[model samples]
Target chain A: MSSSSPLLAELIDALRCLPGVGAKSAQRMAFHLLERERERGLKLAGVLEQAMQRIGNCSRCRNFSEEPVCALCASSSRDRHVLCVVESPTDLAAVEQATGYRGQYFVLLGRLSPLDGLGPRELGLHLLTERLAEGEVEELILATSPTVEGEATSHYLVQLARAGGVKATRLAHGVPLGGELEYVDRGTLAHAFGSRQSVE
Target chain B: MSSSSPLLAELIDALRCLPGVGAKSAQRMAFHLLERERERGLKLAGVLEQAMQRIGNCSRCRNFSEEPVCALCASSSRDRHVLCVVESPTDLAAVEQATGYRGQYFVLLGRLSPLDGLGPRELGLHLLTERLAEGEVEELILATSPTVEGEATSHYLVQLARAGGVKATRLAHGVPLGGELEYVDRGTLAHAFGSRQSVE
Candidate 1:
């Protein structure tokens, strides 16, 4: 740190806040910004500040939005009776991009990790229950992830949906398309085999 | 992109300005900054702006420094007569960290890449020659990288130094310490064998 200027040291320390960026990577990033792309660096600072100040969570869906209601939740074209639950906003975006589903979405914000002090409350299950209690939602689709925490969160929510007299469903687990059976994990292969459907 | 909020999209685009960061990594970084470390993100923006505005080339060695002359060049104890020419400030820092060399440094800022239109002027070789003409410098150490461009630059500088009646030296090329003979590249092994030093 003594080898670099105070400005450089501060930039490097700030860059380290980025996920997966270590000390060496931070230094390289700082140098790239300072020496190679100063204008872009300045623009990045402006955009970061503006975005941070303007962005917030959608009050209902828990996805990112500048306003209280996100675009997806506010849209009339989306099916209000069907709701998709996901572990994060990124997952919600991926689903929207890759699928033809036109249902409303509720982002869990994170999966339930009781060990990390995350539970039903952290996943915003109370808000979800409130939404379900309104009696408008008929189907709850769980799309959290394929991980243990995602499964546990889905299980908890499925019970909540059933209690509210709503149908609860989850994404089907199977071998990925174009995947070789030999290369697939044993658990996934077994699950796919056990859940086999008749070919039409 | 259409599904994400405007605030989120702007942040992701800004994050893409970072070196080695792509669209997916940019999205992940944006989400992490917005959802997990907003305060640090704000601080990072501030630090980036401040560093971009303040840091510039050191007047003497052309390395990064906030002051007119860098600490290494300005220090009273360092030998002004022995100057080490390196490709970048990072190289200068590495030499200082790994070696006991007590010499001043001259950063080339780049190397002689003729195809990319880089030549003596681009590498600040004219300024270096002017410094040599002052006659205070007794030796010029060529510490460019081991690439083709670096070798060509070093050879050119050696001729410049010799014309000015100043001694020129280069970092020794050899098999790296702790390197396995079986794994060593052919070029390095040949260089080490050709420059073999006699035992006392």
Candidate 2:
């Protein structure tokens, strides 16, 4: 849209940097900030600037952090023996929120996607290898997504765990708890059926 | 969600000031920025701060502007004899983009809603009255939405136009273009039927 004000145009254009925000949504956000939420918008700008400049990855787990090490990785209360590996901070957050796994975490920051130039080095596998070789961790839980890349990343991590004499396990792939069998997609249903476990 | 970093938490909280952004979307936006778009995020912060601090209402038309007057109001190419009044700058942009209108514009910035504390004064109708009284405008177009408050605002503007001895016109309201009669809402169909006109 042709905005009469150059600053308004710039604001709208800048808002598009956010995920899922397009031209119309950006315009709406700019107008909203201008019309009603100028104070909060200013606060957002301040916070955004601070986050972009100060927030860094945890030196140990590679999760986002303002300190040298993230709080989760630095906490002494968390278990050090069982390490859950996730692809990104978002997935780590999902696991933290949905499950009761209170062990330590290792954030890969990305899956092993060679086409996207993401490899073991980019994912900070060396740090994970060092952690595993420290002889503290007894188990490595592969909690990456079930996508092809996620599986490959998990498989690679399993080898590293084996080399370090740590037990490696994968998150179960099956139909969701509430999902009906008939409505489940063929791939998930087939995988669930093939991996059917004996009733405990 | 429990963010490991306080700055990350603050960033997510601040992002919710945007229109339509909730907790989940804010978290996603924060992570997306942290993970891949830190440079753009910082750029957005700079632009957002500049926009919030520098942008002000146009002295003549009440549209957003960084200077004393907006580009549209300052343009000599636009006709000064006809003025289109809109509820907001977004509406003004919509009219400017969707139509061939070349006249000047007056942005109310809001409609007449007493419960929401939006009155004629808040809408900048005083400036508009002064503009109409200047005798430069021959026609005052009421382009407000057809909601209860918008209708009331338009009715009040009509009186202002009459008092200023200027002709007043309203946007044609009926079934939307390409809308089938069967699918059109009852109120719109009834209004369209009542205001049926001959093809010119």
Candidate 3:
């Protein structure tokens, strides 16, 4: 039956905004949460509230963390001298899942879209310049996707790194056109990282 | 990345149990709830918890309701003498969405499944006899789907209603073979209701 409570309907509508969820699926999820074990559902709500309240971007690499620095940046085993630039924390996660990367990551948080008014300055290019000026980062790996916007982001980063006197390179080609990094297999990611080429 | 936080992961797992939700969709929803507005997410949780805690089977019809008697059952406009019987609350809602019937409903809560050890006794068939004995219901409509199990449930209910001395009928022949009532459009449902045939 149609929900008598408008609050319940609003909540379900909010949930429907999540990727790939439609009205019927959202209704089922809402009903399951409301009509089954509610404590478990509330616990999830608590987690969401806590994460939104506490999670922040790492000052150094921009991966989400509870502290000033992310776990990867804080780890001494990772090579700080070879920084890998990526588009988002989600992409950084896919790379980490591959388990072959032992380098630091610099997440852009978004790709350049000039038509959408997104440019280097808006994407924290100045902060990246400051990080490069710290003189520890020597080799910079561009691991953004092969998409038009991703390519533009990588090229801009390469110019920024070169101007700052750091060696800049893009990950080796093999990433299919229009393919997201999340869809690439771990082995392909490892191969791409191993065969990275200089971006002249 | 797969959610590292146990609480968030549990919630996501629970959400994924809803029909049509996959792992990727669950992950995306989990992230949205965690990263976006916490209040909205928590409100959804609260709705779920409240619904499960407060809503339960309607005393008169056995359909899920926030009150002792469901809105449909208590409504002055609805035909109290006619009751549409269904297998579950989801099925009840499906019929209501069709908007062809202005009568109330009686949800069986489950169908008879002898193979799964679910018989009429297990599905509260005894309680149905009590309602039929009240003698207010003039016509009983079998709105249950045409599935093997659904047919079995309908057959059993028809026998019970006949012995109770009530006029009983099954929703008409227009419904597609092996098709569920939830998938049928309102027009067909209206037509089916208008052409309902008496059941032996």
**TM-score value, chain A, candidate 1:** 0.89
Off by over 4 Å in 3: A3-11, A31-42, A114-117, A174-200, B2-15, B32-42, B114-122, B173-200
What lDDT is reached at residue B10 by model 2? 93
List the lowest-lDDT window of 10 residues for candidate 2 chain B: B1-10
Candidate that scores best on lDDT: 2
Q: What DockQ values do the models have?
A: 0.64, 0.82, 0.29
For candidate 2, give the docking quality class from DockQ. high
* Winner on TM-score (1 vs 3): 1
For A95-162, candidate 3 gives per-residue lDDT tens digits of 87776888888888889998988888767778799999999999999999878899888888888988
Clashes of 3: 2
TM-score of each: 0.90, 0.96, 0.78
Q: Top model by TM-score, which number?
A: 2
Candidate 2 segments whose C-alpha is farther than 4 A from its true place: A1-3, B1-3, B114-117
State how far residue B57 of model 2 sits from its true place (Å). Answer: 0.6
lDDT of each: 0.88, 0.92, 0.75
Model 3 chain A TM-score equals 0.81
Query: Per-residue lDDT tens digits of candidate 1, residues A78-192?
Result: 8999999999888887888789999899999998899999989988889999999999999999997888888888889889999999999999899999978899999999999
Where does model 1 exceed 4 Å of error?
Answer: A113-119
